[model samples]
Target: MRNKPGIKLTKEKRAEMISAIKSYYSAEREEEIGDLAAGLLLDFIIEELAPEFYNQGVQDSYNFMEKQLEDLLAIQKQ
Candidate 1:
């Protein structure tokens, strides 16, 4: 059996991360603040955190992807 890595983060840590990300983008471009914040959080998880939390990577990806698709479809119907 393979040993899983422990990658735990608290809410404070996540908030700190989001703040650093906002600072970086704030220096780089004139992006919309809300979009930048959301994108930063998504990118941080996908790039930094998902591999440790998900033993089965594709399963996590598919689940979120499907939900996003369903949400989009619902919005289209409205």
Candidate 2:
């Protein structure tokens, strides 16, 4: 998958995440995966799922700010 559009993690961070991915599979499923496989899995997940997660995060921020504003308005009225 050359030139696939995706966010790039720093090499160190990427290594750590790849390690985590391997660990997750080992711990959760009792299966050991290779570095290449884990890296590819990570790429697939970031490419496919990151946008939905990002949107959810944006929505969460909006909800939190709206609640905070409501509280501030109530205080201001007092």
Candidate 3:
């Protein structure tokens, strides 16, 4: 993935994500991590993994629109 600027989240959203991360670690790993650690993990994910996911979503949307355009063209008068 290209080096892109860090993703920005609203304060509320960041808090929500940090909570989710903490919950995931508690439930899945049986470990308790603090807010700072959870926030760091969130930063790592956003910086390293989010671009690939974002690219896939963009590709999927493009493919869907392309198919829809093709279908629309098929109905045009000859």
Candidate 4:
């Protein structure tokens, strides 16, 4: 199947990109570590990578769970 307009990468390519980013984040850096890598990850996801079925199957579920926990915490706080 052809890639859609918004998404620039194939599913395998996206996974590889994400894996590389994650690995880079895990490594210790000379300068600011977590902040820079995290910002890059967020930007890449928001801009470059397009969601695929497999990506949705994994990432979306985790994001939903995280948001649910965050919401629950907010409710408890209130």
A best-first ranking of the candidates according to their TM-score comes to 3, 2, 1, 4
lDDT winner between 1 and 2, please give it.
2
lDDT by residue for model 4 over 1-78, one digit each (tens)? 333355456767766666666666567443334545654574556555545555777898999999999988887743
Estimate, for each residue in 1-78, the C-alpha lDDT of model 2 and write its tens digit.
456666778999989999999999999999999999999998888888876898899999999999999988887754
lDDT of 2: 0.90
Error of 2 at 40 (Å): 0.5
Give the winner by TM-score.
Answer: 3
- Model 3 Cα lDDT, one tens digit per residue, 1-78: 346686789999999999999999999999999999999899889999887999999999999999999999999998
Backbone clash tally for model 3? Answer: 0
What number of clashing residue pairs does each candidate have, in the order they appear? 0, 0, 0, 0
Write model 1 residue lDDT over 1-78, tens digit each, in one string.
Answer: 134554456768766767766676677875546645655575667556777667577788999999999988887754
**What are the TM-scores, per candidate, against the unseen true structure?**
0.38, 0.76, 0.91, 0.32
2, model 1: CA deviation in Å? 19
**Model 4 segments more than 4 A misplaced:** 1-7, 29-78
Relative to the true structure, candidate 1 reaches a TM of: 0.38
> What ranges in model 2 sit over 4 Å off?
1-6
Which residue pairs come into collision in candidate 4?
Answer: none
Off by over 4 Å in 1: 1-6, 39-78
User: lDDT rank, highest first?
Assistant: 3, 2, 1, 4
Regions of model 3 farther than 4 Å from truth: 1-3
